[model samples]
Target: MKPDIRGRQPANRRQKGAAAEEAAAQHLIQNGYRILDRNWRCRTGELDIVAEKDSVLVIVEVRSRSGSSNFGTPSESVDRRKMQQVRSTAEHYLHVKKQYGRPIRFDVIAVMLNAELTTASIEHIPNAF
Candidate 1:
C-alpha cells in the first residue's frame, strides 16, 4: 500500500511522481548543475528534465522504477523508439527555445527506488545517446 499524502499534501500516484522528480532535481542542483527546463515538451514527446553542466546542453530523461537494475533499470528502458523521440525533442528544444545551440549531449537519469518508494540511488549516464 502507498503512503497517504493527505492532511499535508496530495494523495495520488501523480503527486508522488512529482515529488520524486522534485527530489531528483534538487540532487542535480547540489551537484553543480543548472536547471534549464523541466518537463519540456513538443508535438512529438517530452523530455523529463533539461540542465546545463559545464557548458554542455544536457537532455535528461528521468525514469523511476520500483527496484534495482538487476533485471532492467530505468536507464536501460530508453529503447530505440525512445531515442528517436528524444532526438526529435532535443532538436525542437534547440530550434524553438534557442537555449541549447552548441555542445550538446543526451543523458539518462535512472532513479531507482525501494519497495517502500524511497530512493535507492540515482544513476547518471552522460552522453548516453
Candidate 2:
C-alpha cells in the first residue's frame, strides 16, 4: 500500500509523493485547476487527488519509486486494475453528488526517489493511465 501524505508524513518517499502532489497541485492552481479534494476514499477504492480543471473532473494518481531497484518505474506500476478503480471512484464521487455533465480524465504523477527515499524528480503525466 502507498503511504498517506495528507497528514504528517515522514521524510522519505512518502513525503516525496506529497511533494510531487504539492507541486502538481500548484501547477494546477496556476493553470486554473480548482482543487476539490485530496486523498478521498470509500469502501471500494481511493482517489489520490481530485480537482476540477477546465470544467472537467481530474483523478490524479501519485506513484513513487525509490531508485527502481525492484518496483521498476513509477508510472509503469499503475496497471489497468488501478485505473479501473480510479474510474470507479470517480463515478462514485459523481454519483454521490449527482453531477454528471463534466468530462473526467485520469492523470499520473510520478515521483522518483533516491535510494534513501529522498526526492529525485517529479514527472506529471496528464491523461495517463
Best by TM-score: 1
> Candidate 2 local accuracy as lDDT?
0.77
After superposition, the stretches of candidate 1 with alpha carbons farther than 4 Å from their true spots are 1-16, 68-71
lDDT of 2 by residue, 1-129 (tens): 444566544466456667667766766787788989887888779888888877888888888766554857888989999988888888888888678787888888787766445567777888895
Ten-residue stretch with the least lDDT total in model 1: 2-11
lDDT (tens digit, per residue) of candidate 1 on 1-129: 444455343235665466557767878899999998998888999987888899988888777676446778777788999999999988999999776548888888877766456778888888888
Itemize residue pairs with steric clashes in candidate 1.
none
Model 2, residue 5: what's the lDDT? 65
Q: What's the distance in Å from true for residue 10, model 2?
A: 8.2
**Which candidate ranks first by lDDT, i.e. highest?**
1
